[model samples]
Target chain A: MTEHGEQREVFLGRVRAALGHTQTIVPDEPPAVDEALVRLATHDDDLITMFCDRAASVGMHVDRITADELVDQIVAKLVELDAKWIVVGFDSLDQADALNNAIEAADIQIVNWLAGGATMDVQFDTDVGVTDVHAALAETGSLICNVDAKHSRGLSLIPPVHIAIVGARQILPDMLDYFATQHDATGIALPSSQAIISGPSKTADIEGQLVTGVHGPGKVFVYVVEDV
Target chain B: MSASTTSLTLKGHDILFPPLPYDMHARADLATGDDQLQRFINNATLSKDLQRREVCAQTFGDNYDAMRSLAAEIKQHTLDHLDHYLEQFVDAATGTGAHVHFAATAQQANEICVGIAKREKLTQCVKSKSMVTEEMRLVPALVKVGVEVVETDLGEFIIQIDDDAPSHIVAPMIHKDRTAVARAFERELGSPYTENPQELTQIARNHLREKYRTADLGICGANFLVARTGSAVICTNEGNGRLCTSVPRVQVAIVGIEKLVPDMNHLAVLLKLLARSSLGQPITVYNHIMTGPKRKHELDGPEQMHIILVDNGRTEILREETREMLRCIRCGACLNACPVYRKLGGHAYGAVYSGPIGALITPMFKGLDKYPDLPHASSLCGACYEACPVKINIPKYLIQLRAQMVRRRITKWPDRLFYGLWGMSLRHPATYRFGGWVQKQMFRAKARAAGTAGRGDRYTDRGWLSKAPGPLAGWTRARDLPTPPSNSFRYWWKMRS
Candidate 1:
C-alpha cells in the first residue's frame, strides 16, 4: 500500500497502465446492448393484470379500483392502520382534492417530511405515508417514485404503512420501458433520488427467519386506479 | 445447562481471521466437527441454492442463461474500458454535486473518510450494509477517531455488538443461530434473552432506530455505479440502506472501482440477476438510486455527499490474466453452490471475501504464496460457475491459479517430486503397466489381509481398503477407499477384440 495515497490523476494513470494503455485516449464505444435478453414483458402483454399479479406475489397488497372508490378504500386502509398522523404527497396524485378532503375529514393530521430530507422526527411519528408513483413496472411489480419539491422521498418510506396510488396509465410493460421514457434523446435523465420499491422492508438476519417491518414500512398498499 | 428462565445463551466466540491468510485446513477441521453448525450451514446453503434455481427458472424461463450472458458481457465491457469509464464517472458525478475521491489503499480510504468526518465535525454515524466498508474495516477506524459509528443493518448490527465478522455476503450471519443473536443482544444491549427471530429483530430495530434519528452522517455501499448518470445504485431488502442515505445530513458511499456500468439499461440487466440470484426475490425492497445529494428545493436528502472510489488491490487483478474475475456482482450465489464452501463455510477462506470467487480473487488480491491452500480448496466443481449471474467461470481460474502455484515452486518438494516421477511413469507403456500392476496387487493383498473383501457392485469381486498405509491413510480416515479394477482398459479392449 502507498504511504499516503495517489491523486486522482496518478490513480487513474495506474489504471490506464494496468489496462495496457500507452496514454489516455478516447475509450471505445460500450458493448452492443441486446434488449431481447433484458426485456421480460412486451406491448402485447396486459400490463395491469401482470403488474397486479406480480406485485401481489412479492407480498405487496394490490387492488384494482375505480376513481370513485379511491377515497373510501384509502380512508378504510388508514383507519385499519389506526393512523392519527400521516404524511401525504397528494398534490401530485390524481383526484388530489377529494382524497385530501376525505383524509382530513377522517381526522388524520398530515405531517411534513420532505424538506431537509426524510425528517425522521415526523416520519417516526407519522403512522402512514401516501404518494403517487411515477411509473409502475409490470415485469417485477415495482413502484418508481422520483423525489421533487412537491413529492418527498419519505412519504413512501419511514412509516409503518405505505399507501401508493398508481395510475393504470402509468403502468409500463417492463423496467426497460420505464427507462425508455425516463431518458431523452441526449441521454438518460435521472432524478436526485428515485426509489423503486417492490416489497415490504424485511430481513432474514437471525437464523434465516424472515421478519417484516424492520426499518421501512411493514406493509405497502398499491391501489391501481383504472380510469385515472 | 438445565432449562430455566434463561436458556443457555450461545457462547461468545470471536472468529479470529488474521490480517492475512493463515491455516485454512485447521479452520475447516474445527468447522466440520461441529454437528449443529455443519447441519445449519448445509441446510441454509442448500435451500438458498434451490431457491435461486427455481426463481431464475420461473422468472426468466429459457432466457435465463441469455440474461446471464448479457450481464457478463456488460460487466466485461466496463472492465475492459475501466480507465475511460472511471474518468467519465468522475466527471459526471462531480458535475452533479458529488465530491469524488480516490484512495490507493485501505488506509487511504479510511483516512479520507476520517478526514471527511473530522472536517465536518460529524460524530454520530449511521451505516447500512456495505461489503466494501467491511473490507476497509471502517467501523474500527472511525471508532478510533472518536466517531460513534452505528451499524443500522440488522445482520451487521448483530455482528457489530457480538464482535464478529460477517460470514456470508448477502446473509452475513448465516453461520450463527438465533440463540446466538439472543445472547448477543442480551449481553450488549441489556435486552432480555429470547430465541425468537421476530423479537430479536424488534430488539435490534428499536435499538438502531434511535441512531438513525440522531445520526449526523450516513455511510453506504454501492451495488452498481452508473457512469452515464453518475449515480450510485443500492439494492437492499431492509429499509436501513435508504434511511442511511436519506436520514443523515451528510452521506458517503464507499464503492469499489469495478462496479461501474455504462448506463441505466445495463444496470437493469445486472439488477435483474443480482437479487433473484441472491435470495429468490424479483428485486430488493428498496432499489434507491442516488444521483447526488438532495437537489435544490428538495425537502429530504443529504446536504453534502461524497463518493470514495477505492483501489486497494483491484488494479493488481485488473492487470493479470484473472482480470475476468472482476465481473463479480458480490451476490454470493457462487458461495451457496460451492461444495467446499457449503462444508467449511466462509470463515475458513480467511479473507474479507470468501467462497469459490473468494478462493480465486483473494489469493490474487493478496499473494498466491500467502494463500496457496485456497486454490486447492475446491473439488473442481462447476456448481459455482453454473450458479454465477455474471458467468465468472471460477473453476477455470482456480485451475489456472493451481498451475501458477506449481510454476512458481510454491508446491511442496516431496509432492512435486512424487508427481514428477508419476508423470514420467505414464509417458512409457511399460512403466505405466508395471506401476498399475504393482499398485493393484499391493491394495489387493492389503484388503485380503485386513479381511475386508467384498463385491465392488455385487457382481465383481473388489476389496475395500478400510485401513491403508503411509500417506494414503488420510484418504480412508473418514471413509473407505475402493480397490482398482481387475484389468486395465488396454487389456479389456484386447480381450474384447
Candidate 2:
C-alpha cells in the first residue's frame, strides 16, 4: 500500500515537473474575497436596518423586542392574528408553551413537528408555526435550516406563514460560510439533502413572472432574537 | 438472481457496448486536433471550468474540503443500505399513489415501459436527456414498434435530428459547433440561417412545447428515487423535465435500480454534490419530485405514475468488481476533468457514453472482450478519479480492463511477435547490445557514404532511411522520421561513466 502510494506520488511529481511550476496548497486561509458580513454585525442600529430592509423587500412586517419581552410579544401577536393552533419545533416546545400560557385567554393547540404533520394541520388548524433558525445570512437576509431528527425538514418549508427565531450569534458572513459550517459540523458525511433556501418556495417557470409559495411556504417571518 | 434473468440482463447490457476493434484510429485522427470541433469543445469545457470554480469559491470558500467530504459521506451511507431504503421508498411512493415496477434487465424494463405505452396505445412519446434510455436504446425499441420518440432536451434534440447518438454525456453536442448545429436545424427544421445558441434554444423550446402539450406518454430518468416516499426526483436546467412529468397523463420514470436511496435525507446529500460538481450552481433551476399520478382532486400532475426500476445490467454490474461505477450520480464531473477527453472530445470513445466514466461503464456493461480497445484509450493520468465527486477510482478500473484484454490475448500474431521480441530484448543485455551494435554500424556506413554526415541519412525508394525497418510503418504515418544516430545515449553515458 505504501509502495502504491509512492508510485502515485512519483507519477504526479513527473506530471507536475513536466508542466513546470507549482502552486502552494494552503487551507484555513481565505481566498481573497470581500468579507461583506463584517458590516452587518458592526452595531445594534446596523442590525436593525438589515432586518427592516429584508422584511420590506419580502413584504413582511418587522418588530423588535428584548429576550424577556419575547413571550409576551409572541402571545400578543398570535392573539391578534387569531391563532387557533400553533406548531412549534422540537426544541422550541417549552418556550412556545410559555407563550401559550401568556395568552391563556384564547385556546390554541401546538403540533410538535414541522414535516408533513405541520403542513396537514397548520394550513387550517394552526395560525402560526414557530421554528428555531439554524443560521442566518445577513447578505441575503435568509434564514437557514439544517434538517436532522431534532429539526424536521418541513418546519421552514411547509407552513404558509413561518416565524423563525434566529439567535444573533448564529449569523454567518455569507451563504457559503453558512453552508460550510453545516458541512464541517456534519463531519465527513452529510445528509442526502441540505437545501440552502434564500426565501419561501418560488417559481417563475410559467410565463417567467415571479410567484412565491408555489409549493413551500407563502410567507416567512424571522424574529432576530437579540442578546439580553 | 436466476440464470435466465442473469443472461437477459447481460444481453440487454450488451446493447450499449461500442463495436469491437474500436474504430479508434479514425476517432483519434479527428479528435486530436479537429478544427471543426475545436470551438465547441473549448467553449463547453471553459464554461464548466469557470462556473464550477466560481460557485465552489463563492459558496464554500476555504471550506470546499468540508463540503466535498460531507457530500461523499452522505452518498456512501445511502448506497450502503439501499435495500432498506428501496423498500421504504416504494412503500412511501405507493402510499402517495405511485406504482413502482422492478425490471431485472433492459428487456424487462423496456417491456414494462412498452407495455404501458401499448396499453395506452400511445403514438407519440417525448423524452428528456436520460443515460438509462441511451443504455437501453429505448428510442430504437419505440421506433421498431412504430412509435415516434421526441427528444426535448436541446442537446438531445440536436443529436436526434441528425440520427446521431449523444457524444458527451452532459453537453452531448460538445463536438459540434454552431455552424453544424445551424446546418442541422436548416435541414431538419427548415430553420432560417442563424448561428446563435440562444436562437437555437428558442427554436427547440418552441418546437418541444407543442409536443409536450399533446404527448401521450412522458418518459424520463430519475436522479434520485427516495425510498421513503417512492418519489422520483429530477434536476434539470430546462423545465422540460418538469413539464414532461406533470403535463402528460401517463408519466413513466425509467431508473437504474441503484438510484434508490433510504429517504429524502439521503436525497439531500446527492443533490449537493450533483449541483456544485455539474453546473456550479447552488441548486438546479428545478428539483421536481413526483409522488404518483395526480390525486383525485389535484389540479396538475400525471393521471398515472409508473416507475420502472431497471436492473438491465446493473445487477450484474453490482456483482462485478466495478460496482463502484453503479454509485455514480451521472454528474459528468469525471468527463470534464479528463485531459484525454478534453483532447479527444467525446466522439473518439464512440458510444452513447464517453469519457472516463464511460470508458469504465462501456466495457463492464457489455463484455471487456468485445470492447477491449477502450481500456487502452486512456493515459491512466488518474485525473478522472481525482475529479469524481464520489471519488470512484476510475483508472484502477481502466487498468483492470487492460489486464482483462491481455488475458483474452486479443492482439494479432504479428503484433504479439513484435511485443514479445521487444519484451525479450529488454530482459536480455547481450541480445540488446548486439541489436544496438548492428543499428550503429548501419547508421555510420550510411552517414559516411552520404558525404554530408551533418545532414544525416539518405532517402531510400520507400522514403527516408532512418532505418527503423518493417512494422514501424504505423509510427511514421503522420510524423517526420528521425535518422538513427551512430551511437545511442546509453552507450555515450556508459563511456562517460
Candidate 3:
C-alpha cells in the first residue's frame, strides 16, 4: 500500500479510537420525506415575493412575467443591453423552445456550450450567457445550476452579463427546503458541479471597497416566469 | 509510530513551525501607528458584524438560534461519527471519479499536492483563498519544486505579492490600506501606482484572468464536505472559487477532515449561517458544490479531481475538550467580534488561524507549551460565542485551556504564584482581609514616597505611580497605578453594618 493509503487507515483508526468506536457505525436514518416536506411547507408562502425582494437587494435585476412573455422579455433585455453575442446551455435549449426561437429572431449570434460545441474562448468572448436554474432559494435569492455534459458551467459564469430563467414554481423557501427536496433514503444524486449563485460577482478585498465584475459576470438578470 | 506522536516531522516530511517573524508587541505597535489601517479593520469588522446581525435576524427571524443549534448539533453528530462519514464521503467522491488522498500532517499534505503537480508536470497552479492551504503553507512547497503557484483571490494575491501573512481570515489584506496596496503593486507588478480600489481590483482581475487561462492546476479548500452527495462546497464572494474549479485541467481541494456535513440537509443549515456570520451577505456570490472532475462530455472543468483530507493536528483537537474548535466553518465571525483581535489584528496571533478561535486552537494544535501565551490573550469576553454562527462557546474553551495550562504548570511562575496566593487568600475571610490591609499599606507607602519625592499629579493632588517596581511593572508601564484606599472594603462594610 502507498503511504497515503496506510495513512488513511491509520487516520480512520485514530478517529475511531478517539470516538470510542471499534467498528464502522452506520449513521441514523435520515428524516422521512413527508416529515421533511411538512417542515418545508412552513416556509412555502410568500416565496416568490421573498425571492424577488432578496434577489433585487443583492444586485440581481429580477423581472417577473408569464411563461409566454419570458422570451420577449429576455430578447428585449438583451437588446436593451446591446449584447451582440450570447452563449446558452444545452439544457436551456432543450427546455425553452420559445427562448431558442426568440434568440434566433433577435438576430444575436448564439454559441452552444456543450462538449463538441463552443470552446472556452467562444464562451469567454460572449456578451451574454443564459441558463435555466434548477432551483432557487427565496430567502437568499440564489439560483441553483447543476453542471453536466449538457449544462456547461461556463455558460452562466464567463459572460459579462448572465440571464438566469428561474421558474416561479421552482423557487424554494430557503436552502433547507432545497436540501430537503434533494435528500433520499438511499443516497442523494448530485451533479459534477452545482452552483448556488446569489448575485453578481463582487469583492471588497481592495481596502474593503465593494467592486463588482471582478472575474465573473458583473450584471445578473433573473427572469422569473410564473408558468413553466 | 503511534498516531498521537507530537514530533514536528511526520512521514519523511518536515512539518514546520517557524518562529514568529515579529513579536506581538511589535505588530501591535505597527497597527497602532497606522491609523488608517486601524480605522479600516475597525470599520470593516464592525460593519460586517452589524450586517450579520441584521441579515441573520431578517432571514431566520425567531428561528435564528434554532438554526444555530441545528448546525451545532449536525457538526457534533458528524464529528462523533466522523469515521463513518469520512469513509462514506471517500466512497461517494471516488464513485464520482475523484481521487481521495489522506495526509496525517501538513508536510504530508504538501507532499501529496506536490506529488500530484509533479505527476501532471503542472507549471502554474492557481489557488483561491483557503485558510487550510495557508495553514499547510502549500505555496512555498509548490514553489520550491519549481511549480509557480498564484493566489487568485484579490486580497490573497496582494498579500502573496507583498510576502505578508493574511491579517484577517475572510479579508486577507484587511490591515493593508490602498496606499500600501498601490505601492506593493507598483513595486511588484510594475504597474502604475493607483489608489482607487476599482482600478486596483481591475488590474488584479486582468492579471489573474490570464493566469487562469493558462494555469494547469487549481487548488482550493472545501467550506463543507457533504457526505451524502460527495461534494466539496466552496463559498466565495469574488467568484474565484468557480473560476479555479472550472478553468483548470486538474483541480485539488485540500480539506480538513472536520469540514464534513452529514448530508446536504445539514449543509443547508450551515450555508444559512456561514455567509451571514462571515460577511453579512445573504449568501456569497458563488457557492459551488463541486462533486468531482468534469464529466466525459463536459465542455469545461477539471479533467482530474483530487480531494486531500488532511489531519495535521485536527485529530488531536477532536478530543472531548477541544472538539468544539472543529465545528468552525472558518467564517471568521469570532475574529470580527473579538476585541483582542480587533486591537491587535491577525498577525499578532502568529498563527494561520487568528482571533478567539485561533487563540483556542493554537494552544491545542501547536501544544500548550509552544503557544502558552495565546490562552491568556483573551479577556474571557463571550462576544465571540455570541457572534459564532455555530455558537462555539469560545470563552468557555479559553477558560478550559487556561485551567489546563495551570494544571500542566505551563503558566509563568510569577502569574501562577500570584493567582495561587490570591486563590488561597480568597478561601479564608481573615486572610483575605489581612491581605487587603497589607496591600493598602503598601500602596500608602508608595503614595507617600511619591508625594515626598514631589511626583504628585497636579489635577488631583494625588501621588500616582508612573512606574511600578517588581512584577507589577508589566501593568504600570502603559498606565498609572492609582493608590489604594487606606481602609479595606471589608473594613468599611463591617463598620457600616
Candidate 4:
C-alpha cells in the first residue's frame, strides 16, 4: 500500500512537470469582476412576474397568494390534485399552525420528514412531497433546495409530484445573484447536496421523444407567498 | 475510518487502447444502408442544434458571446494553475469528511474503486451517466469482482442492458430507435415489448427504482469540481443523479482532473451555458452539488464519500500545444453542429468521445498512432468552433494533429508523395499553370470519352467520373469528380490581361 503522502507528492510532481513549472507560481489576485455579476446585480423586472413566467415556461405551475391565504391555497391545491397522503419538510413546520390547520381541514394523512422515522418506502409511496426553497432564481426558474436535517433531499425527489413554497423575498434575479448573496452571507462551504430543480424530471432519451416523470417528480407546483 | 487507515493500492491500470470494434468505413457503409436510421440521426442532430440556438438566444440574449468568452477564460485560468487548484480541492474535500484519492491511470482508478467496495463490503451498486466511468470501463472491472452494478439513468440503463456503448455524450442512446429499446427490455428484463417512449421510460423507472432503493454503493461523475468548496457538481435532466448520491450508503465520484472551477461564482457562469448548449433547457432538472458525505447533522446522504481524481491522460493533454482540448465541457453542441458527425454518426468515430471535440482529444488521449483517422474526420468548416460553449478552436487542434501525423510519417506513403508533388508544383507559377493545363486536358478528354461536353466550371455540370486513375480514385468513389474546365483560370486571366 502506497502512502497517501507519497502518492500526493508524485501526482503533484507529475502535474508540475506537465505544466512546466519548476517552482510554485502564486495565484494572482482575482479581478474585481464586473460582467455577469453586474448584469444580474439587481432585479429590475418584477420578481413575481419574472419568476412565474420563467417557472411556467419550464413546466412548473405557479400560483401567487398572500401569507394569510396560504392555508386556504394549500388546502385547495391538495383538494384539486386529490392528494390523499403527503410528506412535508420540517422547515415548513414554523408555519405549522397554518399548514397543520390546512392539512387537518383537508383531512389528508401527512408525515413530517424531519420528525424522524420516515423510511424511503414511505417517502416513495407518498402522493406528494412538499418543501420550502432556500432560494429561487428567476433567470432559470429554478428552486435551490439545501438538504439538511429538517429538509430531507427526498422531500423534493422521491414523490411523483413536488410542491415547493417560496417566500417572495427569496426569489433572486439569477444564479449569479443567488451565489453572491448566499455565499457571502454563509461561508464558501456548501451542504452535502444542493439541488437546483428547474422543472419536473424529464427525459428525451428514447428516440428523441420528450417524456416527463422519468425518475423524479412529474408535476411540480410553486406557491410564491406574497407576505411571508 | 481515519484518513491514516486509507491506503493507496496501485494495480495494473495502465492505459489500454482497444482496437476499433468495427472499421470506420464499414460503419459509414452501414449508416448509408439504413435510410430511416440516417434520417433519425439527421433529425435528432438538427433539432438539437435548432433548440440550442433558440434557448441560448432566449437565455443569454445579446450576452451569449460574452458569456462564452468568460467561460473560456475561467477554464483557461483554472487549467493554468491546475496543480494549485487541485491541491486546494483535495484539502477542502478532505476537511469536509471526504476521502480523496489520486490515480495516475484508469487501471489504478478501477482498482481504487474496487478496493473501496471490497473494504466497505458493498454488494450492489447504482450508477448515473458518467462518460469518464465509461472511458475507464469501470463496470466490467467491478462485475469481474462479483459486484453487481446497475445503471440508473434511463438512457444508460437501456444501453447497459443491450451491452452497447454510448452513441452521444448527453443522450447516450441517441443512435437507438424505440423499437431497439423495446426489444432490449423485453429480452433483458422479461417485460412485454412496447414501442411507446413513455411506456419505455416507465418500464425503466419501475425496473431501476428498486436498485436505487436497495443499492449499497452509488457511483457518479462530476460535470465540474468546485475548487473553493470541494464540491462535485453533477447536472442531469433525470433525477437519477440525486438518487445515486443520496440513496447509497457509500458514494464514489470519478472525476477527470480537468473539470474544475475556482468557486461558486465561476460555477454559476458554467451553469448558464451547460444545459442551454446541451439540451436547450434553461437548466437541467437536477444540479447536485455534493460536497462530502452526509454531514454530522444530515439525515440523508452517503455515510462514506470518496472522490477519485483520475489523471489517465489529462496531464499529458495539459502540455504545450494540445492543451486547449482540455477545456471541453462535453455539451455535445459541437457534435450537433458538425456536418460529418450528422452524416456518419458517433459509431463511425469508434472512440468514447466523438465528433469535433472527440476528433481533437482522442488522438491526444489514446495516442496519435491509435486513432490516426480521427483528425481527418472534420470538414474544417468552423461550425464546431461557433457552437462550442467554451469556444475551443477545434479546427486549430485538428490541423495541429494532422501536421503532427504528417511529420511523424504516420500518413500513407502514396498520400504523402501526392501532396509532396502538389506542394512542389504550387511553389512555382510556371509549374502550377502547366500542371493545371495538363489536368484540364485530362478532364476534357475524360468528359469527351464519356459522351459529355465540359461546358461549365461547376463539377456537377460536367459528367461524373465513376473511376479515376491513381490517387484521385478515392474521391471519385463516393462523389462525382467534376471534370476541370477546358481552360485553366490562369489562362483566362492571362487572356483578359
Candidate 5:
C-alpha cells in the first residue's frame, strides 16, 4: 500500500476502535431500495412531459419501463445511454453481474466499487458510475446515497454520468419516512456524508441564468429493477 | 483603518460626531453617493421585481401570497419553539457522536472556534462562502492569532485579493467586471491573464486544489441545520465547499442560532424555496450533508467535527422589536429587490450586512441609538417586504426604529421642528391651506425670477426650491427639481368646477 493508503488504514482502524464494535443492524433481510419512475402511469400529460423535459435539463433521460423484463430494460438503458465505462457498488454485485454481461457483450469496461483503492484517478476518466441506493424518495424524486464500505459514495458523485440502479421496493414517501428508516437501521448512528441527489448538479448564480454540471454529475440516470 | 472617529453621516442629515443620541442615517447618506447609488438601487430592485413576479407566475400562480404567508407562519412557529427544537437537535447530534458547542456572543463563538483550532494545532484553514463569518469578522480574528485563512469561494477570493468587501451578498464582486477579475487573479496568483470566465474558473479551481489538500482546518456555514439528524447542510454551486469539508483533517461549521429547522422535511421545503428564490434553480451544484466526522471504515472525511452555534447579539435582537431581522435566510432577495441597494451596492452601507437588510441590521448590532440615521435612509417603498419570502415587515420595523430614535431624542432638532411644524399644519385646516398657499407663492415667485434670468439654463438656478437650507442642501447638490404649481390640486379642481 502507498503511504496515504497506510495512513488511511490506521485512521480507519482508530475510528473502528472508537465505534466499539457495535453492530447496529443484524441484516435479517437485505436493505430494500428503489428508483422512482416519475411517469410510470399519470393521467396528466403536462406533468409527464415536464418530467421528460427536465430530463435533458440535468442531462438525464426519461426511459419508459415495463413491469416485466426489469434486468433487460436496465442493462439496455445503460447501453443506450452510450456509457462505455461503468462503476458499481459492492452490494450491487448481483445486478452488476447482469450489467457486466451486457457490457461484455457490448465490449465495454465495468469497474467494481472498492472500499479502498486509487479510484480518484479513474473518476475523471470514467463514463458512468453506479451504486445500489439506500432508498429513493418519491416526493422530491430524489436518490439517497450514503458513504459506506459497499456503496463507495465517491463513484455516485465523481463521475460525469451516474446511473443509480435501485429496487422498486425501496422507495420512501418523504424525508421523514427516510429518517425513520435511518434511525431504526442505525439506532442513532449517522452516516458520514448523506447525499440526497434529486437531479444532476445545476446552478443559476450567474445573472440568474440556469447552468448544469457546475460541480457534481452533469447527468443522473435511475434504472428501477424488480426483486430477483 | 485604525479607530477613526465613529462620527459619520446617515441618510442626508448632519449631526454631532461621536456618541450621538441616535443611529446616523444622515451619516450613511453622506458616506453613500446619491447619484451612483440610484443606479445600483434601480438595477437590484428592477431585476428582483421582475424575477419574483416570474417565479410567482411559474410556481404559485395566484396563490403566491398564500404560499408566502404559509411559509412565514411555519418559520414563526419554528422560531417560537426554537429552544425545544434546539434541545432536540443537541440530543440528536450528540446521539450521533458529534460535538455541539453553544456560544452566546461573537467573542465566545470565536474563542470556541479558536480553541478547536488550537487543539488541532492547525496552521492553515480553508473556508467556503459564509456570511456568518463576515458578521463576526472571523477571518480577521483567526489571522490575529496566526492562522492563515483562505477563502475558497471565487467571488470571496476575488474580493480578498483586492482587499475589498463584498459589494453584493450573493455576487460579492458584481460591481467588478471580468477584466478586473482577470487582472486581480493574474496579479495575485501569478496565473495567465485569461479573460474567459471558464479559464478564470479553472485557474481558481487549480489554485484552491492545493489549499484544500494541505489545509488542516475546514470552516463552513450551514444553509440549514437539520435537528433530526444533527446534520448541517451546505448548498453551494462550487465544489470547493465539498473539497474543503471532505479533505480537511478537522471540519468546523459556524452557524447562527436562527439557522436551525425542526427536521429534514422542513429542510427540504426551505431548500426548494431557497434556490428558486435566490437564483431560480431546481438545485445547487452541491447539497452536502455532513452529520459528523468520518465514521469507522469511512475512507474520506474529517477526523474531527465541531459545530459552533453563534448567538452574536442574536438573542438581544430577539428580545427587541427587531426580531424579524433574524428571519432573514441570507438569500439576498432583499438585496436584489431593493432600489437603494442596486444604486449604492453593499460597500456604501459600510457594514458587513448591506442593502435594506443591512440598513435594518447595522443599527441593531451596533446599537440603534448610534445608527438612528439608518432608519430614515429608506423611501419606505415596501419593495423589500414584497421580495422577502418569510415576509419580514421591513418598512414597519424601519418606521418603528425611527419613532424610537425620535423618542430617545437621537434625531437633530431641525427635523423635530420641521416635523412638528409639518404636523401642526395638517391638524389645523386653515393653517394648512394658508401654509400651502404661501409655499406655492414662494415657489412661483422664485420660478418666475429664475425663468426670466436663466431662460434656458433653469437647472443651474441652485436655490430654486433648495432655499430650505441646512442638512437638506445635499439633495440639491447634484440635480435640480421642477418648480411646484402656483395653485394646489384643490384650487385647480375648484377653478375647473
Candidate 6:
C-alpha cells in the first residue's frame, strides 16, 4: 500500500505544472541516435578473438577449446580449484550423466539445490559456482547471466570462484545485440533478473588498491567451447 | 541548515558526516594542510583523469565528441518530457508486479521507505552505494526507526563503521588510505589492524558477505531507469549489487526521476561512457537489469520489488534554464578533471556531491545563499566541460550562477563593488589605459621595494612580486605574481604602427 495514497498524483501534478503541461506528454519520437556513432565494434570483426582478448584484458582467464575437450577440461579445472563442493546452476550440460560421474569419481561434492529450503545458505558454503552463460559479448567481453526457472541468479555470483561455459555461437558482437536479442526472444517480457558480467568482482576502494572477490567471485574463468 | 551545528548527528546516532565547514578558508585549509590527503587524493584523481582521457580516445577515436553530444541530447530530451516517460515507467513497472511510490522531498522518501519496513516487519537492511541515498540520509533515518542497515560496498562499509561521510561519488573513500581502513576495522569490527589494502579488502569482503546473506530487505540506487521496459539498470564492479538485490526478500530502489533514459539503446550509450569516464573500465563487472519481483516460476530473486521515484529537488532543476544540468550521468569525470576539486578534495564542498558538477548543482540544491562560496569555487578553467561525457558546460553554468549571485546580492558588497568597478573600467579606453598604467606602476614599485624586481629574469629583466598587498594578496598567497610588462599593449601597438 502507498504510505500516502494521493502522493503519486500530487507528485505527477507538480511535475506536469513544472513542465507546463495540461496533460502528460510523451514526445512523438525520442532524439535520433546514430548507430555508427554509438557502436564501438561491428559485425565484421572476428567476435571469437575479440571476446577472448577483451575478456583476458579485464582479468578473466579465457580459453578456447573444442567440444571434445569440454568434459575433460571441466574435470581438470575442478581438480585445479581443489573444490570440496560446487554449486551448479543448470541441470544439464553436454554429457550430464558422464559429467556428474566424472565429478563424483574426482571426489567433488555437488550441492543438491532442490534438497534444501535454504538454497542460498547451502550455496554459500560451496567453493565455486559453475554455469553456462546465456550469451557472451565481444564488444566488452561480458557474459549475460539470465535468471529463470532453470537457472539461479547467485550461481554466477556469491561463490568465490565462477567458471562459465560459453559457446562460440552464443557470443554477440555488442551490448546492442543483447538488448535486441531479448526483444526477439521474449517479446518485451524479460527474465526476472538479467546481469551482464564483464569480469570478477573487484574494488579499488582501500586507498585505490585493486582487490578482487570483495563480495562476489574473485576469479572468473571462461571456457568458450567450440560449436561443432 | 545552521552552519555551526557540527553535531549534525541525528537521533544520537552518527548517520551523517559532519557537514563541510561553512567557512571556505577553513575547509580549504584542512585539505591543503593534510599530507596524506595531498598524496593519495591528488595522485588518484590526476591519474584517473589521464586514464579516462586515454581510454575514451582509444575506444571512440574520432566519434567520441559526437557520442558525448548524443548522450547529452538523449538526457535532455528525457528531462524535457520527464512527465510522460515517468508515467509510462510507472505503468510498465506496475504491470511487472512492482510497486511504485512517489516522494516529493528527502524526508518523504525516507518516510516511505520506513513505512515499508514497518508494514513488512523487516529489520535487517543492506544497502549498495548510492548518492541519492546519501542525500536522503537514509542510514541514520533507518537506524532511528530501529532497522539495522549495513552499507554493503567495501568503501561504504568502512565509512559506516568509521561514522564518516563518503568523499567521492564513485570512489567514496578517495580521501582516505589503507591506514584509515586498517584502523577503522581494528577498532570497529574487532579485526586485526593491517595497513595493506589487499588484506584490508579481504577483511571487508568476509564481513560484508555475511550481511548480504542475512539481510531481509535491500536498498539500492539506480544508474539508469529504463522507461520502455520498466527496468532499473545497476552497474557495479564489486558484484555486491547483485547480492543485495538478489538475496533479499524485498528489494527497494530509491531513485531520482532524472535517471530515466528513453530506451535500452540509450542506456547502452551511457553505459559505454560511464565506466570509461569514472574508472577507465570498458564496462562495469555487473550490469544488472531487473524488471520486477520474482515470477511464479523463477527459481530465485527478491519476492517483492518496490521502486520509489523520489523528486527531492530535481523538479526545481527541471526549469528549462537549469534543465541541462540534469544531463549529468554522475560519472565523476568532472571531479577527476577539476583543479579545485583535486586540490580541496570532495568534503570541502560541504555537500554529498563535490567537484565541478557539484559546484553548479550544490548551490542550487542547498540555496546559493547558504552555500554562496560554491559558485566561485572553480578557476573557470573549463577542463570539466572538456571531460564531461554528457557534455555539461560546467564553466558556463558556473558563470551563470555567479551572475545570479551578484544579481541577488548573495555576494558581499565590497566584492561586488570591485567587480562592478572593474567592469566599468573596461568600457572606456581612457580609464582602461589609466587603470592599466596604475597597476603596472604599483606592481613594479612593490617588486623594486621588495628587491625582487628586474633581478628575476636575466633574459627579459621582467620583474616578479613574491607577494601583493591588500585584496590582491589572496592571488599571491600560493603563487608569485609576475610584474606587468613595462608598456601597455595599446601603447606598444600604437608605437609599432
- Candidate with top TM-score is 6
Q: Which 10-residue span in candidate 1 chain B carries the lowest summed lDDT?
A: B3-12
Model 4: per-residue Cα lDDT over B52-121, one tens digit each = 9998887678888888888888888888888888988888888888999888988888989999988889
- If both were scored by lDDT, which would come out higher, candidate 2 or candidate 3? 3
Candidates in order have lDDT scores of 0.85, 0.61, 0.80, 0.82, 0.65, 0.85
**Which ranges in model 5 have alpha carbons more than 4 Å from their true place?**
A1-52, A59-90, A98-113, A118-129, A135-142, A158-163, A166-190, A198-228, B1-49, B441-497
Clashes of each: 6, 12, 0, 1, 30, 0
Clash pairs of candidate 3? Answer: none
Q: Give the TM-score of chain A, superposed on the true chain A, for all candidates in the order listed.
A: 0.91, 0.65, 0.84, 0.89, 0.66, 0.93
When 3 and 5 are scored with DockQ, the better candidate is 3
Full-model lDDT, candidate 4: 0.82
lDDT of 5 by residue, B1-497 (tens): 11123434222111111343443343345436555345544654567557756865575566666656655655655555555556666677766666777665677668777878876799999998888888777887788888999987777787777665676677676655567778888899899898777667657656765676578999999888876678899888755577677767888888986787765656655665676677555555467888878887766668788777766667656643555677788777788877667655665555667778878987887777666556776888998898787788988988888888888877779988888777889898798998787765666577566563234554433225544345556676775545554446878888997
Angstrom error at residue A124, model 1 = 1.4
Better of 3 and 4 by TM-score: 4
Candidate 5: tens digits of C-alpha lDDT, residues A146-199: 876565546766676777765656665545566656657645566778777767
Q: TM-score for every candidate vs. truth? A: 0.93, 0.64, 0.92, 0.93, 0.78, 0.94
lDDT of 3: 0.80
Q: Which candidate leads the pack in DockQ?
A: 6
Q: For candidate 3, what is the DockQ?
A: 0.54
TM-scores for chain B, listed for all candidates = 0.92, 0.84, 0.92, 0.92, 0.87, 0.92
lDDT (tens digit, per residue) of candidate 6 on B384-452? 999999899999999999999899998889888887888888999989988888888987887788777
RMSD of each: 4.4, 14.0, 4.8, 6.1, 9.6, 3.0
Cα error, residue B380 of model 1, in Å, equals 1.0
Which stretches of model 1 miss by more than 4 angstroms? A1-5, A113-118, A185-189, B1-16, B19-21, B440-471, B482-489
What's the lDDT of the predicted structure labeled candidate 1? 0.85
By DockQ: ranked, best first:
6, 1, 4, 3, 5, 2
> Per-residue CA lDDT of candidate 4, range A67-140, in tens?
87777787788889999889887355358667876786788888765667666656877889878889998777
* Residue B143 alpha-carbon offset, candidate 4, angstroms: 0.9
lDDT (10s digit) by residue, model 3, range A181-210: 766535545678989998999999887789
Q: What fnat does each of the candidate structures reach? A: 0.71, 0.00, 0.62, 0.59, 0.20, 0.74
